[model samples]
Target: MADRLSQVSGHLTNSYGRGLLAGEVAIITGMCWRSWSGIGRSAALLFAKEGAKVVVSDLDEKKAQIVVDEIKAAGGDAIAVGGDVGADDFPQKVVDAATKKYGKINHIVNNAGFTFDRMLHTTPDDAWDVIQKIHVRAPFRLIRAAAPHMRFKVRRENRSVINVSSISGLHGNVGQANYATAKAAVVGLTKTVAKEWGGFGVRANTVAFGFVKTRLTQAKEEGASIEINGKKVALGIPGAKDDPNAQYPHIPLNRGASPDEAAAGILFLASPLASFVTGHTLEVTGGQGI
Candidate 1:
């Protein structure tokens, strides 16, 4: 089933031409993960297929370069920028990279983040702070860094800012108190950006995803882990039954989304197709929490 889905996604991507996002420049962060299932990587590839020059950012420099190579091999324009978004200077560096390569930024997809899940009672202070720093503070800083480019004095075209959120933010999740609070703040930040930048023809929105089959959602027993501050932080759900069908019964589709599927939602918001859509949270869950 996964292979078939990949084939279909590849076909549709190849079908895209210089139409929806032609002549646009975009910066998409978090474009790399151990597996090729990062939503940001998918978004970068999809955006490039639609004719957008992409600036792909990720903490893993080598992995990010792989995605950049893939884009260029597909006859798409892209450059890899490696940095930690949690760093104070990294956001400006991303903005600089985009402007330096593409001349200007038209779209910003704040998709660089991770999860450090723990129940409220067990959550550590540093865990909560780091989650907010990565998920909420990073986006805020990136937008602020790109404001001069996007919030132009005399705008020439429609610009977009798509912030990635989660259903956990909208409807709290177990063992995700830190994640939920940070994601909820993301919605407020996006709405404020829309309100402040609407007159400049800049649209800001959020994509609230539910379950997506990425490293973050893979079973913890798989041993996929990310290092944070010298400590190994494990990724994925604990005690997952290893059955997609049995795992997501609450979702109407009874399955988690593929990264490519989630990227489609980000593509729509960044494309001209959603010219008038702003300050909205397009939930990409399979009818979960409805």
Candidate 2:
């Protein structure tokens, strides 16, 4: 029995080591200091583990380099590009960097976005514009810039795009009108691109995440509630999941999703396993808002 168990463990370990994306190249945006275990950092790490050569892009050069360094330390291939996604030149720079480093870009993850918590009535015009520019305008421009390159590759190869959205966009959260509106625009953008680019062997999709532990959540105080679709959902203080108020009673899974879990979904959509899927929004919220 001991020998049999040993053999089984050995097989499992071997199977786990075979890389899923041995020769692919992935471009991940918004991988900066603000991304504390959220979509940006999680996507970068996950893509590297899958054996893809990763390109980490963010406004902060230091933060983007940190992710690249971590991937290299783990024996994975990666590089970093620093630029503002909202800039007109940023999208082209990201694509050029990825192509120069990896020879080709197989996947793109548009995950650069920020949320400012303020009631619509209290939100300043400048804040609203900035939020939309970062969340909606940036992704739209990046995808537009990357699509031609992806289409060119698709004529000779295949590619995918994974846009990160949020439950707030789907259900409409209070004090987050700016964020919700921007995310909803992402969904529309994803669908439109999927249709426009489908003929080129490229797929586009969105991942709408629920509450996850990240710097955005950290900004909120402990035991705060945000209204979703007219229902109140309590948000836990960052790093304090043990607090009873943090528990999501409406979630069928009885817990919030981890960034890794959400990242897995994005990776799947970007993988060959989801070649037939496009223009779809996959919600990774433990069945919340379903």
Candidate 3:
């Protein structure tokens, strides 16, 4: 009798809401930092909150462990693996470490990246190569490393890969030739991966974002930058104010999305809710890019 009453109440309202990813393990890359917290960190936190154990991969060991500690404090499961995505060995290292700890891989969110904006005339060979390696090559290798575990496994459920992109990739942005090229390349790669991996019940998709106020997009007045290898590059948009989107007169939503808001899009694609969604790009820009 009590169980029947509870069921009726649950139907009417919310019954403490079981998480959408109640039984999964996810690998999220590019999660780090003290001031420049971006979509990667937000997505990792949300995924863990949604009942998925997580592997927090980032360039900085200290910052990566910080995210893992936060997840554990919230009663969620997580571990940190620090390595440069641009390194040849890092992708496989991430996969090996994840499988050793979690036993299996269920989701891959390729969110590690940084923008090295430069005009076409001034774009150096090294600059272009770095962006491509981090944004394009890393995603390709990570997904490939995880594919063997996902494909032809009798007990495996549908697995997914979410490649993080930028609005600049969809609609070319000036002064960002290298950054834009790498991002755009991932979209094409994702579409191809979706087709080839579909037979194995694995899905591939992209999430392109507009102005979300991370250190990468914060106003220069905030003193935002990222140290790549050893060089400190100015890593943010200038003159957009603290709320980059709110200051924009053309944005449909009238404000920029918070990190959590941007993360919601990635979380959706990673969850079972998007099991049938592949080869698609979900723009979580609050209608900024149209």
Candidate 4:
């Protein structure tokens, strides 16, 4: 019995570990500080675990390096590229970092963004502009910058682009006018990419996430904040799920998703498992709004 169990365990490990994305190179953006368990960091680590060389990008070089170090400690290959995604020149920098180090690009995940929640009437021009720049424009620029590497290849390779969206974008949210618009634009952009890049066999998709337990979803009163464009913006809800009277009757799962869970959805879209899938908006919402 012991020998049989050992054989099964060994087979499972060998078959699964370092196989899904072997020989693939991936670039992931928006890996936040270590203190906040963001989905981008989770996806970076998970992709490395699956045998892909990873490029981790974040606003803070030290924070991105932390993720790279973790991947190395786990016997995976990774590098850190820190920059502001909203910067016009930064998207090209990210693509350059990947192509220079790995010599190719197989996957791209545009996951760097933050919400500036406010009613439509009260939302300022800067707030709207920043959100659109980060969530929509950055992804567009990155994809365009990576065109020479990903498109018009002599020998076609399986490539993918996974753009992160929000449930609010699918079914509007209060006080998220700017955020919702940006996310909705992501879906349109992804579909267009799918159509335009299909001839080259490059897949583009969007993952619209529900409530996830990241810094973005924490209690605002906790004082967690992030600086954008030389201004500080508070993060999270006030009561959130911690409120004694709060309940999650809307979500069939009855709870928010973890960063790891959200990352899994991104992984699926980037992996060869979704080779035949493109221009799809995968909703990782725990059945919410369904």
Candidate 4 error regions (>4 Å)? 1-18, 153-156, 242-247
lDDT of each: 0.88, 0.78, 0.84, 0.88
Where is model 1 poorest over a 10-residue stretch in terms of lDDT? 8-17
Q: Could you give candidate 3's per-residue lDDT for residues 75-162 as a string of tens digits?
A: 9999999989888899789999989998989889999998888889998887888899899998999988888877764433647889
List, residue by residue over 1-290, the lDDT tens digit for candidate 1.
79855654553454354457777899999975764479999999999898889999889878788998999999999999998999999988989888887899999999998899888999999889999999999999999999999887552375899999999999999999999999999999999999999999899999999988888887888888899988888888876656645656799998888899999999999876676799999999999999
Candidate 4, residue 271: how far the Cα is off, in Å: 1.1
Q: What are the C-alpha RMSDs, in order, of all predicted structures?
A: 7.2, 8.5, 5.0, 6.0
The TM-score ranking, best first, is 1, 4, 3, 2
Better of 1 and 3 by TM-score: 1
Q: Estimate each model's TM-score.
A: 0.92, 0.83, 0.91, 0.91
Q: After superposition, how far is residue 253 of candidate 2 from its true place, in Å?
A: 1.7
In candidate 4, what are the lDDT values of residues 1-290, reduced to their tens digit?
79855654554355366577777899999886537689999999999988889999999889999999999999999999999988878978988899999999999999999888888999999999999999999999999999888886543355899999999999999999999999999999999999999888799999999988888888888887788878998888877765434568999987788899999999898876676799999999999989
Model 3 clash pairs are none
- Residue 250: error of model 1 in Å? 0.4
What ranges in model 1 sit over 4 Å off? 1-17, 153-156, 241-247
